[model samples]
Target chain A: MPPRPNQCSQLSGDDYAESGRRAPAVQIDDVVVEKGRVRILDGISFTIPAGSITGLLGPSGSGKTTLMRTIVGVQAVRSGTVNVLGRTAGSAALRSSVGYVTQAPSVYGDLTVRENANYFATVLGRGRAEAERAIADVNLTHEADRLVGRMSGGQRSRASLACALLAKPELLVLDEPTVGQDPVLRRELWSQFRALADAGTTVLVSSHVMDEAARCDRLLLVRDGALLAEGTPAALCAAARTNDFEDVFLRLIDAADQKAAA
Target chain B: MLLVVPSSLLTLVYSMFHNQPGRFDHIGLTLLAVFPFLTMFLITSVSMLRERTSGTLERLFTLPIGKLDLIVGYATAFSGAAILQAGIAGLVAYQLLGLDTAGSPALVVIIALSTAILGVACGLLCSAFARTEFQAVQFLPVVVLPQLLLCGLFVPIDGMATWLGHVADVLPLTHAVSALDAVGSSSDPTAAMWQDLGIVLAFAVGALAAGAATLRRRAA
Candidate 1:
């Protein structure tokens, strides 16, 4: 079935500044999320600028994935709202424009690399030509017909990214997109990310690797579901009086822990 | 896939050959005689199993797709495949086996579809109760085996205890088998077949509703 037009609306870069709203590509207002009895997110609010890269950095169990899920509209918000491309997250209209690649490879193991892309495109209403292009974007054009199960972890990750880019989304959300990648492939993937951003796509990437954070135009430091800080990597390092993004992150995490204890 | 088709056909042909002689030869039963239980335990349960195995269920819940749409899409995909298998088997039976069946081919197709739908529903519901695929597969005999004894496949309905018969009467497959037999064997459409259709529809609709609720609640 053709993906509903509303689902793809977020993919289009148009209407971003219509009626003087500034019209963020992604916006979360007073958001709260709970899993069972544990509060996962608390009153989080932020906006991702169109055509830029935003990095979310946190340690494990810091609620980074939960926050990402909330933005995609998969988890129900306990309170507050999440909007993607100006429409509510999970809204039928926003799903099409939002491409999400989870931390794990989400491709079908039984299907070939290209078949996985084909299935996602079919659901996303992307044409065959677009799918082929997405295949080329990830440098998987030659391995397109190979079974996903046979592909290496890095190749599978690339295949997953290819699937995410199949519809040419306006907002791309990737959780640890470069986790298993080698150095050369990692550089190539980062370049692909830059190209997407240059083309007016808002990319939100989550990573524990501090150097990756340096690559983003903006950074949101999250620890235990609260925002530690948000700013450009250089500004954040300067504010923390640290030489590197990793040192800045450690300093902020330590400070938050000390403050909580006191 | 082919197993589901040929197995169903074999049951019918065996029944005709046995010809034990009764108003109902009580021979070749529809796939529902076996499918609802197996499907409830196999295909229907696979969506959840896949999600859990891949850790995608939780990830998927984080996406924008609704719980209803997710289940519906999965079921639709499996049902489409099941229908294809049924069609091929039916075609082979018509041309090769030369079985003199009655009623519209569409009706037979509906019979197969309803069986698949019920199978998917049962599989999904059973999956909700299982923590692993092994546990899910274990549900097969417990849930499906009863149909053989209770659906009058091996023993005549008359031979069953009154209480057992009463319980069987309510099962969707009990009616499905009756309806398919009516059409496949050239018997007149009986009130029993209509009753079975209603019951099967109820099973499909009820499973979908309850299954979605269960999946969503756990997904969070």
Candidate 2:
């Protein structure tokens, strides 16, 4: 059985030295990433607290994906530092500790869902029980024996998610995971993310949808390769003087544009 | 099927065109050099490119596996097909076609296997430059066709212009064809045959190193 929400924190705290304050799960200090001549992420800095669900909210082409990639240690940066799980991002030591799910489904099409999960689990030094539990966690038990190629688009994405979940990674980076999912499934997945956070996992999920912003414990609002705002959902909404989160987000972007114009 | 069918058809056509009693040796040598090389190159390139375009390669890189492990895994997996292909094509060209060669038949099979493995190495290097399967296929003209035209399977390098002969000397398939020719016409493998084999193996290793250097965790 999985540990309860409160017990999970103590479990993780024992592994690292918690002198007086716990270190953040992720720390980025003025990270700048460039692709060719275009700056994909411009001087971004933020710290993601351990065991929390942090939403990376931004418009399309606003560098949300690039930020996630940097955290996962896959995206090359032109400058700055990205520390994940107390180590440098993309270090060999973090390979098994970090789980990343891309926008597109990333499982082998020729393999059955179970086989895909098992293969990744074994790569991470986990066993079959973990693979099966991960399959069940994603609610893909029914499709376990089916080839990923024959599954529906949503099913395939969930299969990819299951593979990532196999190792119970300390840091999970998901890029637009709920894009095409149905309302009920999205709610369930969001709850799952919450449950994982409660169980001492740091989940950094990126989404363009404003409605999902409320579900995150903390939100990082990004626009034009720069961070526009970072705070709790209620604080941001109150600061923008709007109850509707979408309106608050638009107002922030408008404010940023006007500031730049001035 | 990839090697046997094309080689049998080519041998049949060549024999029909020549209509000579001792022409099977020429047919056998051509089949040994061209069939395995072409098939492995086309198949490996497209399949490996599909892994890139489908995003599997990106996920695989995130795993604990190293880049060299992935490249060698691909090479080893395809080499199984290459082995079977060389064996079948060699048997069909030698026994079924009644091709008579002065050299040891085992030497011809060895050349065919080397050429197939070489094809796999070159395919992997070329796959790094292609984004889609169609782009992988486009490399056929720029990469494989020139080697076919200059490899001395259809025309002797000696009969070509000096510059063209020089160009042929640089291609892996040219060395492969020369080795096949040397083994087909002599009782023992010549020094030139050994040198050409060494050159073909060098090309395979060099391309593999380049492929490893060029592999990216994600498509740019």
Candidate 3:
């Protein structure tokens, strides 16, 4: 039960854990989030390595959003801890360094995209120029003048992302950032995630889309408020004896179901 | 709300009793008694509910922003609106409709601002308990109605049931009405008027503190 980033179920046991690698961006140990009568995250444990794109993939309502919130330090934990950036999760110190994009568009609906980003930028002690750059980074420059409420679902979410990115956080937690986007935009978002990771920003994104799983450097396969598996895409597919992510996902679900039954 | 409520009270109600010797004075006092306390509370609570539902509060909390930061931010924004509203209401009553008060109209406007702040604080606190806008609106009855009913605008506390009189003494709106009444009939506010102002402001501060205490990291 000690904090082990590399010992998760079906881990690829890859060389990413070698010497001189940075410490984990996040370490969640037996984190249990109970809201009223229902347990939203049941003893979910995992580690996300620094500067890597880790996808948290699962079906809808499988606690992906809850787990992401847990890392962002907003979701109250019943029993266990989530340590991010070497301090307690949600610590005031982490605020400047961690970027969070909620599943809902958290920006003001009445404000233009630029104004929305500028508000967050000002919160972080930055300015409008930074907001413009963040907007451009999310490829929302064309829609920067549009009111967030009037924008399409995809644009609104991107505006949310642009605002989060204004902090230039070392760790980015996004919940389904590409959910309503077209295929081309989705591809662009994946590459943007890739680029952010390459620049040493640890990216943790949650999505139900399995194809998106293939683009992550690592994947935390979650279901039923618990982690079913965590490993590289190839390792996950190989362990299930199938190359297709959807097939392996169903296989893992069945295996977990059997384990629960036993 | 600030302009329309007082303007209508001046035009419609004062018109009906314009022939009465002292009716304009009662109208002026009555407008200051309950208008700000009611509308500001409703508007502030509903807007706070929007912040909760939109999930922006979570994002704001996650920042290095302290609870006081949010509380004060909301307080200042709504308080600014309240003061502006009071200014307009005061101007419309004194300059346009000739709803006369013995005290400086400035003092009346100040009392309205105090009651408006109390409303905002109450709204902020109630919004913490509400999950939806409808629930927030429902609180108007539970939170605002008792104060309105017992504030003695309809009947003096001396004529009310003994327990109801005690309850009115404890309500913030009662203090607001008493303060505005002192301003209505006298050029120099009585000692009791100062005490009433203190009570209204103290209640506003207490409610805001309670609201700040209710803010939590739990998912809304």
Candidate 4:
């Protein structure tokens, strides 16, 4: 069972998960992000432990994507620090150690799958064999020679993932990675996630999928840039005294809304 | 695929001045005659415009690569065909025109390459300021066309509208044409060519800095 936010805090950071360091792989301390004068991430703070799988669960417009971009150094932190891999997100070494798979597939439409992979490898300093292995890992080897534009949506997502994994990053951030994937493929991908965590790679995934939220080692429930609740799916359910993660997710969202209104 | 821009430049030069234009005067004047610089402008600016239009600019910002690498990579990649076009133009000029060739042929090739770089730099600066490919293209007549019209190519530099002539004197290509004209005539190489090279380098560096700033703003 997952611990309540406060309860989880009590469990010495190391005891919370298999993650090695007490310091987080990603740490956001009082981050406030804005886009064109509109606040997107409003003084939010959280720490994702190394080697743990942390799922960011939120309703739409909850600033999930904004937060993820901040962690990857693409979005500026209006105020506060974002530390990843023991350095600021903007640090070159940290950039190399962190791989990001954005919501949109970043593959070039005109390039073949293999060409796309090769381009990434060349730019990211990955070896050919490693790139091929990543393709194989994502089960994209069969589609390697096909143009990215012609591939199915799910295959494009898989190719995007393979490209992200090519760098063999220690901290991987995936935003709604399984969006267009089939149920079986989702299951297979989560299994791969588990393997990645087992190998000591910290993973941060953002998703609205409730069942998927239940599978993550921990969850950060957010709404309107504020942390609504933080715990494992089971712990949240226990706190709400319900077995359903969806119900727990909803109740917390409602509670946060009510509090904000008051 | 990306070779279209350079090939067009070569074709424009060939179509305009039929029968090989020999001698530096004929080749240089002929190149200056057609609007080849416009093609170079489009080639250098279009790629950056495409990146922004396709949402790939944001994607590129998320990568680990340095800003310098991005600038240099795109510039170097586009330079290959630009050099090829210059070579073909020179060869065609040699065969078609009966101008006597003097001095190291390699020096001419170097000058041609430097000129291409100047053109690319100008295009890059335009791309830096433009939000879309169309906006960049609009700059063609206002920015590049004047360089051709007033840079002492067709009309003597002294004969143009006084202010236009002054503006043309400051143009980067004006110095380049001065150098080429001198080289073609096998006369004393004017200091104007060195000045043109210096000005082109300045423009290239300024454009690169502007590009880096734009990229930084986007990332932020």
Candidate 5:
């Protein structure tokens, strides 16, 4: 059987703290990513602390997805480096240790929800029972036998999430996972992300929604391929002298524009 | 089902017009040579493109699975379907259409299977270059059509221009058709037939390797 959350203290506390002190779950240093002639992520640097939820907050096309892809080792970087779990990003050794969910639902359409999850679990060297647990965690046990293609948009995304959850990866990178989801489902999913983080999994969730930023342990507010600020939501709001994250974000962007002008 | 109906109908019509004792054998050999290649190529390319467009391939790339595992898995799965299709086509040609050949029937079946496997390999290679299903189908005309025209399916390779004959020699389908023709004419598989089969298999392996090399985690 897979180790329960409580039993996985090695992932949570002492070792995690030691590791956190030495190295983060993910580290991006002077990273630059370009698509064609356009620079997508320009000289970005950040470290995600282990055993916490880090929200990557940005407007659409602000390079949030590109940054997440770089972290997962799928995106090509023109220069600089991304290190994940103490290895170079996209290294074969980190494959099992990292789980990623793209913005779009990425589950196999021909396979049932359970089958898709099981296949990924098997690929990650986990067994079928873990797949069942993942499906249940995503609250898709009722639709386990249903084909992913036939599922509703929300359910299909959940199925994709379930697939990523199967390996119980140490680092989970979700790109707009709660997009198009209802409020209750979104709340449940946030709780699930928190629960995973509480169990020692480092969750890096990207979103364009500012309200969700409050739920994160730290927020990396980005705009136009640059990070405007990185801090806890409350800290960021206090620094900007505003409680509204949206206002804070705007103020930061304005500050960046003025700095560039100067 | 979709491929067999039209091909079998065409064979029936051609045989009725020819009206010779051994004409069905020629038609059968041609269909066996071409149908499996065309069907498997179209099916594999489209299915792989579907996987890419649907995001499954991207998701799979993030896992611990290697590129070889994916390419081989696709090849193995489609090869099973290819075998089944070849079997059904062979049964229809030999039993239903009364194809008469001096060569071993088993050799013909093996040749059909080889063509199907070649199709799978070539399709996979082509899929790596395609972004959409339409683009994948476009390869049928740009890639497969040229091979079909020059594969010695219509004019004999010996009768073609010297340069065209050299082109045919390099085309994998040319060797496939040559092997089928050899098996159809001779009582035993010849050294030439074995050589042609070897080249066809080598082409399949090479194409598969190329496909693996070019496989991307995401569509560009």
Candidate 6:
């Protein structure tokens, strides 16, 4: 994938003002999610601007996946609302406009990667050419005809990601998409995401790795089912008095712990 | 996949029951009573279980498809396969093995088709309750064995205990078995046979709806 500069940081004040006239791609207000009497997401709210890569950074079991599911409209929310692409999240109308990839590889094991893409395109009422384009976008064209079950783990996940990209969605929500990828493949994917965001697709990606957060145009630091902070990476570093995201995360966690105790 | 099963089953039956009196009708009854239905059931249940365990089912729910699309798609595909299976199985029993029936042999194939659809529906419903493929296989005994034993194939429901007879009256496969028996014994499709056929189809529809109801879009 060709390298694309992070669009969120490159925008001038007036250029951002021009895009701000329109609504954000995603808007969440006081969203609370509970599963089996345990609160998974406490009252949390955030908005993702169009044409930006927004990273959702948090440790395991910190509710990042749950938040992504809520935005994609598969998880039941106990209270509050998640709005996506100007419609209620998970609405039928939003179905064609939003693409979501779960943490695991969800495509058929028996079908080849290209067949899975074609199948999802049919499901999304999209054409075959677009599915092929998605395959090329993920750099899976060489492995397109191989059965996903026979492919490597990273290849299988990329096949699933290609299926999600079939819709060419306005909003994309991915849950830990690079969890097991090699460094080179991970860099390629990030650049692909950046290219998409530069072309005005809102990308929401969740990851526990702090290094990945530096690649995002905006970062939402989450811990223990609550939003700790939302700002640019530079701004967050300034506040935490550290350039390293790992240290910034530790400092933020300590501050939040102290605030909760007080 | 469709043609291979019936020929092998025919060979097995022919090898075992050579020159028996009324062998033709007995094999005909067996064709209608069990074969297509069981095969379809296993096929649907295992495939659906794979879908669930592999996370593809949950992923599909997030896509643009409706619940009916998934349910009906499975039903139609499996039912279509079962119809082909029924044809091959029926052709072997009636033409090659000389299995005889009083009613039009076409009616026997039709009844088998309907019963196989019921199998598909029940399989679909069972998969919703099963979390693993092993658990899905286990449901076969709970859901099908009771019906097979009490459906009046080996011993008539009338000969069984009063409560057992009443339970047979409620099981869908009972009607399917009785309808096949009616076609085997009488030249015309009897009123009781029509009623039994109707009951079998209604139960298939109900089971399919139950399967759909059990599937939730916002699954936790």
Q: RMSD per prediction, one decimal?
A: 7.9, 5.2, 4.9, 4.7, 5.7, 3.2
Per-candidate TM vs. native?
A: 0.83, 0.91, 0.93, 0.86, 0.92, 0.94
Model 1 reproduced share of reference interface contacts: 0.23
TM-score of chain A for the candidates in order shown: 0.90, 0.91, 0.91, 0.92, 0.90, 0.92
The parts of candidate 1 lying over 4 Å away from their true place are A1-23, B1-5, B8-25, B30-41, B51-77, B80-112, B128-131, B180-186, B212-219
- Per residue, candidate 2 scores C-alpha lDDT tens digits across B131-186 of 88889999888989999999986788999999999999999999988888888789
Question: How well does candidate 1 score on lDDT at residue B133?
Answer: 82
lDDT of every model, 2 decimals: 0.74, 0.83, 0.84, 0.73, 0.83, 0.84
Instruction: Order the candidate numbers by TM-score, best to worst.
Output: 6, 3, 5, 2, 4, 1
**Model 4 per-residue lDDT tens digits across residues B1-220:** 3334444455565566555454234545436323334556677888777666554555556667777787788778766766676666556555553334443444455566666666666777777678888888888887787777766667777787888778888886676666555565564444765666566667666766776676662354
Candidate 3: stretches off by over 4 Å: A1-20, A260-262, B1-5
Model 5 chain A poorest ten-residue lDDT run: A4-13
Considering every candidate listed, which one attains the maximal TM-score? 6
Model 5's DockQ score: 0.52
lDDT of 5 by residue, B1-220 (tens): 8446635664665567475666556656766877778888998999988877787787788888989899889888888887777777777777776677779888887887888889998898898789899899999998788888887766778999999999889998989888988988899889999999999999999998887777775422
Model 2, residue A115: displacement in angstroms? 3.5
Report the C-alpha lDDT of model 5 over A103-208, residue by residue, as the tens digit: 9999888899989988888888999999999999989999999999998999999999999998889999999999888988899999999899889899999987
Candidate 6 chain A worst ten-residue window by lDDT = A3-12
- Candidate 5 Cα deviation (angstroms), residue B121: 1.4
- The order of the candidates by DockQ, greatest first, is 6, 3, 5, 2, 4, 1
lDDT string, candidate 6, A1-262, tens digits: 5422322233333323444556799999999998998888999999988878889998789899999989988888999989898889889888888888989899999999999999999999889999999999888999999999999889989999999988888999898899889989999999999888778888999988778887877889988788999887877877888767788788998989999999
Question: What fraction of the genuine interface contacts, i.e. the true contacts, does candidate 6 reproduce?
Answer: 0.70
Q: Interface RMSD, all models, one decimal each?
A: 3.8, 2.0, 1.7, 2.5, 2.0, 1.1
The residue ranges of model 2 lying beyond 4 angstroms of the native Cα positions read A1-21, B1-18, B217-220
Between prediction 3 and prediction 4, which has the larger TM-score? 3
What CAPRI grade goes to candidate 4? acceptable
